[model samples]
Target: MTDIARIRLLTTVEHSLDAGQQVVSLANDEDPLTLKDRVGSIERIELHFPHFTDGRAYSQAYLLRRRLDFKGDLRATGDVLIDQLIQMERTGFSSAVLKEGVDPTDAERQFERFPAFYQSDVVNETPVLRRNTPES
Candidate 1:
């Protein structure tokens, strides 16, 4: 995984951010591409996951990263689970606020358990096999 896609695990919703940083929170149904014009001005974007079963936020994150090219922080909020962290990191979330009662330690272990992926991700466009192989 690339450094740009490293996921920061947060146990609580409360965050200490810089005073000047601009944050925009989007509901699960909101389309991230709509904010294409405002991407530069915003410093962070929070995408909501109303429930564990809902996956709209994943699409939003992909659009923001690959489509709109949002370079600032992308955070996952609400109903986040430890099992989703690996996929979340692959999709482009820089941080996630875990749901209540979910152990942060266990969430951290998820990364350790699956250290690498073969498929390409938003941060790492090259597939693992392609990255390792040299042109003949």
Candidate 2:
């Protein structure tokens, strides 16, 4: 037998978060512009890709990484596929939650599909030839 000794009260804070430590979820409809003010302190941003065809998440990821300059973890959840893995990494998703039954090994193998890229992207910020070529 157990007796209830004490109960603690749970209170909610009504203040603006200081150096926000919260992981904010931005939906496809929710513009990342709203987070501009608090982007710096955001530890992580989870961009929900409701379906594979919805490519808005790609733009959101790029905006967050390139425009906002967010260096935190950008995770993709929902409808993640092995075929889109490379694009996800290029756009700036540091981690992803792939759909069920998709082999992790296969998804990882997709990254190696292209050994090198000619243009710059979030993954390879510099063009390969430009960096490798010596000054004339």
Candidate 3:
């Protein structure tokens, strides 16, 4: 398993994050590739989910990490749930501000239950089975 930092569960959005780092927030529909030019100057990007059923933000995170090469923090905000934490991290979200009333401790367990994945994800491009296999 790739050593992903523990997913943070913020009760509220911290407007001023990380000691003056430039933070940008994007609506679910916004295209992350459009920020390619500004990626280097940004320290964090928050992608809103709006509703648990709305998954556009996942695509946004993937584009930011794999296409834009955004190395800084990628945060998921709004409608965040314990069910989404694992996929969020796999898709490049470093943290999340979960929806109101969701227990942080319960959310944390989602990672423990499934520590490793067989499929490729943004953090690990190589499938688990192919990772150590000799080239055909």
User: Which prediction has the highest TM-score against the true structure?
Assistant: 1
From the highest TM-score down, the ranking of the candidates is: 1, 3, 2
Provide the RMSD of all predictions against the true structure, rounded to 1 decimal: 2.0, 13.8, 2.4
Top candidate (lDDT): 1
lDDT of 1 by residue, 62-98 (tens): 8898888888889999889899988888899998988
Global lDDT of each model?
0.85, 0.72, 0.84
Q: Candidate 3 versus the native: TM-score?
A: 0.88
Candidate 1: lDDT of 74?
Answer: 91
**What local lDDT score does residue 45 receive in model 1, on the 0 to 100 scale?**
95
lDDT, candidate 3, at 63: 90
| Candidate 3 CA-lDDT value | 0.84
Displacement of the residue 84 alpha carbon in candidate 3, Å: 0.6
lDDT string for model 2 (38-113, tens) is: 9889887878889899989899998988888887777777787778877877788877776777766777777668
lDDT (C-alpha) at residue 115 in model 3 = 65
Per-candidate clash tally = 0, 0, 0
lDDT of 3 by residue, 57-100 (tens): 99999898888888888889888889999999999899888777
